[model samples]
Target: MDTASRTAIVTGGSRGIGRAVAVRLAAAGQDVAVVYSSNAKEADAAVGEIEAAGARGIALQADVADEDTIAGAFDTVEQRLGPIDVVVNAAGIMALQPIRELDLAQLDRQLRTNVRGTFVTAKEAARRIRPGGAFVAFSTSVTRLHLPAYGAYAATKGAVEALIPILAKEMGDRDVTVNAVAPGPTATELFFEGKSQQVIDRIAGLSPMNRLGTPEDVAELVAFLAGPGRWINGQIVFANGGAA
Candidate 1:
């Protein structure tokens, strides 16, 4: 995969799996634009790492759910790095609450940030991505596993997975690919926060690997989808370590 002259935009690139994807793309010789919602410091750190990997890197701030913000972020990337060739929509939030206890506000937040954000980001990519480009969206294994508290979060990811096939069809004529990456229990801050050691162990044990997944593990798959795995489109690739 000769990505040396290509450019990629990774939303939520300031931390976790998003950060890992951004860095891995950079290491693969793609100029990277790291988009963050609020954390400039973390975004800058990601940019630094991308640059150290011998690729051009820039950090842009934008709320992924807002249409105007997403547009502005894409504009900045185009202006700074040229036409975007790859997009990884990794900006999302997880609000774990039973359906009965889920509030309208929390439900709206999850839908807006996760589902709407993925929609808006993919729309922009569909509009601007060059031929042979790819768009990757994030889903979660919880959508299939159906845990008790993850109703809302899983709903949002389910929406993402549903959109993949349609988006792939829409973008196919342009020689662009659309896909989703569903990760299982990973050792991200979002996954480990507020959990006891026993809880973490139990979660890890859910996977046949008997261990929590690493960001790099997920990122490697994302990198492959963005580069060599372009032929695999409109599908949800689960990097779950055989969990579920």
Candidate 2:
């Protein structure tokens, strides 16, 4: 293996935005490991796409919120691929309900998978990523949109956004950049679930482009940060087509 070859691990990479980012990094000549919570079949498909992109690929199963599990997965990735160059914490869960109507359990699920997951993944990335590498976390435009019924979900990502700059400053000495990508109204399986066409259309129209963001659209920004956008650390970048 070429020691200089970049390697990336993308959580929630079995499908949706995470899958897109993994494939995008592979296309940019980086070996990739797609870490998924479950769904071996989807994970394998993502790896196949990564391989087809002319780069090495593998799939690992691990919970993003579990520190030991993710740490072990990172070890396996380095053993199989190389020292990590990038870690994208694309794994998260969202539940939208008015604050009054929101279930406490739903909020806990979001916090566990979104906040704790990012922290765990980011922790490993901080320690394991090579100098000049990058750590990217996912946020949402809802933080700025302040949409009704998104209180809990938005709050979780807000916490993620708050941590990005602090983590970036902490990693400054190591020459590793840390940032978060805040996508708006992305058209993914998660976004479509429980949303009616009317709701979807209204949200899509919020963008100046009058369309929902595609997973690849957000992946493009992630790919940039993962590779050449080194100066862009410590920011909650909104990739929402002028939305909010």
Candidate 3:
């Protein structure tokens, strides 16, 4: 792919890692559809940033876990900007709860958003993304660290890890690559939500880099995989600064 004017659908594109990916893709000359669950304002803001980067951008609403909504979101993007060349499934939620204290409600929500959401988003992308396209799914380094309070959250990302290779094989002849990016503790709101400064510092120290990741750190790899890294399929690339 030459990377010029390619269209992409980035789920959860309103903030954090998703927003960073959107900005990177746009700066790379790709039109982006910034999909969000409920925050139209944030989505619009992301699109604004995308347009400023010299590519067309649109805001769309879709619960990533819902098949119909995802399908519609893809359709809208293709209709408005043209065929989608990349699909980035970055919409997910994480809550810290050990196995002993895990709440069924939280477990169900995480399963729906992280596991089912990726499956549905990948399914739609498989059906619609143009030839020589790519799909970048998100995972986490915690899946390897076996963090205690991340049982349910890790389980959801584990399911994503299992799908990457299978989806790549299925898309073999189609020329679309499938892969997952597992990030370590990042400085995103999602990572800082409930943690104190001491806890954050402790987690950051676990990585050899002795620092937390930023959205741009993860986005760099995403831009590579979605752009020129077609040979890197069916693998989980850890963008965690060697944290795990």
Name the candidate that leads on TM-score. 3
True-vs-predicted CA distance for residue 182, candidate 1, Å = 0.2
Report, for all candidates in order, the number of backbone clashes.
0, 0, 0
- How would you encode candidate 2's per-residue C-alpha lDDT over 1-244 as one tens digit per residue? 2223899999999999999999999999999999999799999999999999999999999999999999999999999998999999999988889999999999999999999999999999999999989999999998998999999999999999999999999999999999999999998999999999999999999988999999999999999998899899899999999886
RMSD of 3: 0.8
If ranked by lDDT, best first, what sequence of candidates would result? 3, 2, 1
lDDT of 3 by residue, 65-171 (tens): 99998888888998999998999999999999889999999999999999999999999999988888999999999999887899999999999999999999999
Ranking of models by TM-score:
3, 1, 2
RMSD of 2: 1.8
Where does model 1 exceed 4 Å of error? none
Q: Which stretches of candidate 2 lie over 4 Å from their true place?
A: 1-4
Q: Write the per-residue lDDT of candidate 1 for residues 1-244, one digit (tens) a residue.
A: 6888999999999999999999999999999999998999999999999999999999999989889989999999999999999999999988777789888798899899999999999889999999998999999999888878889899889999999999999999998989899999989999987779998898899898899999999999999999988789999999999886
> Any runs in candidate 3 off by more than 4 Å, and if so which?
none
Give Cα distance to truth, residue 191, candidate 1, Å: 0.7
